[model samples]
Target: MDRGKKPTTFFANRNNKIYMDLKDIIRENTLRYLPAKSLRRCTSVCREWKLYISTPFFAHNQSNSFHDLSGFFCQSHSSQPSFISLDPIAYGVPDPSLKFLPEPVDIRCSSNGLLCCQGRTGYKAYYICNPVIQQWKKLPKPDANHGCDPALVLVFEPSLLNFVADYKLICAFQSDLDGYEFDIYSSAEGSWRTSGEICFGNRQIVPSTGVHVDGIVYWQSRSTVVAFDLTSERSTLIYSYSSGSLGKVNGKLCSASIQGSKLTIAELSNPYTNTMQMHSKTRAWSVKNVTLNDSVFAGQTDQKSVLFIGGKIVVIRLGSTLISYDTRTNDIKQLATEVDYDPRMIPYVNSLVEV
Candidate 1:
């Protein structure tokens, strides 16, 4: 080798070693701190990064404290919808069982790892089952006079009491001209019983999606959020938001959503404010607002909220597409397409079960 070109081999090896170390650090710390949106984008970069990021550690980190499972963005073609599992994060990986659900229909998520799916083709029966574990049971039509919203399903929370371990599945339907009525069914009981009718005034909007928080299913319609406590087996009004203020929160039956996590309750305005409160420790909420180009906050705001993911507040927008917001880095990115499933079809995100 010429004297002027000396030490090229040693320098090349040294640089390669440094590059390798940096890549390892990026893989480890990136999974730790990167928002799910950015992490997902990194996975799409290449195969090596995909394998590194799709590990149980990464998935577990992305998993909610309530239940970490793959949520499907599905569509229906039949009247009797069924629960089938799909790899939501995996890119085009065909799921053999996913083919069985040829007849797509509307789906609603419930507690105890159950999903309530109704068909679009006919007035057949409603199917309630867990897609992950594949343990499913069906429900025939409600009583002759009892017509409930097959889209509504009640889910039960996990109990520490070993002897009294069971989950509840509830559904809402129309019985009379009054409005909407509800029925309660328990896996322990295996029977449907009348709960009550919920009549939201014309001014109050009932969000199609009802989140179970604190042993009660909560829903936000136009302005009101209602809760139905399972222990008492009754519905109770929780909170209501005015027209200007958009109220949206997500979770199953647990305090995990409001606690210190990636999920947060933020306020965004012209100043771009964001905040999250801990419902357990304090009633107070953390607030932050920024002055950014109008285009930044231009997306859909009504279906916007911060979700708790791995102890961080991630902004989620339900629109033509699903967007997750990362507050720590002030990053906004799209996670899934709106064509997958309507956010209104299945309101809750977490699958409540030991999957």
Candidate 2:
């Protein structure tokens, strides 16, 4: 080898325009798939990276790729809340128990990266917080009494230009009849507003069964599936005679429940389809029934919580075990053993979203 000159190595192309373009393209695409924590740290890598990561479009893209279930905030009246992560690296929050707040809270509902919690003290005010960033916002209490078991649903849809997520919290206040009315709190307005729509004359909305998908929030009872559209501000019965739990599976509204040894997972096929066609000749759901190998199940299956771990995975409590059942593969795996019986588990997505 000639000692006078050095050979061009792999990084010698670093100065080339085409090489730089390729590197930028790869970096941008790779950044979109990283976990939110890594993306938060990536902002400090460089000013350009920082600007890109902070963009709303980038947040939307990253959110689409990072929709995996981090874990759940298991809430109970007897004990303090707990975080149960399926994978610590992917689903862990900075403070799982939400100790950063001023007071102890009951984790009511969660959407995207935010949580709706009711304070255990002083009029039981509501709070919305991002546990990953340890930021929270206290909401003004509504005029309606939510009662002991309030029906609360948090709705958040991250748009391409929506970096600071504008969320809506729907709380069902009881009507004079057996029905319930909703008080929707908008984060953008920093206030609560009552909606005219009422889940009227129906059984009380099951607070734990609430799940938001698309722009609609769903709560299923033994007789029907009740929904409130965030855009239209209307409550509609989506499904009927559905004794199941509501969750989002594979990016669609799904209902999962265990009956005896058989597991039924129903997907809400089309809510926007022609309503006349839906009510008359067709059903809005496409369902799948999976039979389990074991018959052992937790007590009070009717009231037990059903949570979706991620894509095609349903987590339910069996005795003291938290088991995740894969609907696609019919595989069952134990997530947490010796869990609280019939724990009120609210699914949490660990993200860098701010309150």
Quick one: RMSD of model 2?
4.7
List the candidate 2 regions with Cα displacement exceeding 4 Å: 1-26, 37-65, 270-281, 293-310
Q: How many residue pairs clash in each candidate?
A: 33, 0
In terms of lDDT, the best-performing candidate is: 2
Question: Native-vs-model 2 lDDT?
Answer: 0.75
RMSD of each: 11.2, 4.7
Residue 36, model 2, lDDT: 72
lDDT of 1 by residue, 1-355 (tens): 4667645558888999999999888776655444343455687877988987666545444332334333333333333332222234432212213233434445655443345655445565555654533445556555534333342546655544432325565655544655555677666766767765564344333434555555656554454444566677665443332222222234322111222223433331211111234443422223434332234345435444322221122334444554544445656655555433333333223332332
Candidates in order, TM-scores: namely 0.52, 0.81
Candidate 1, position 153, lDDT: 43
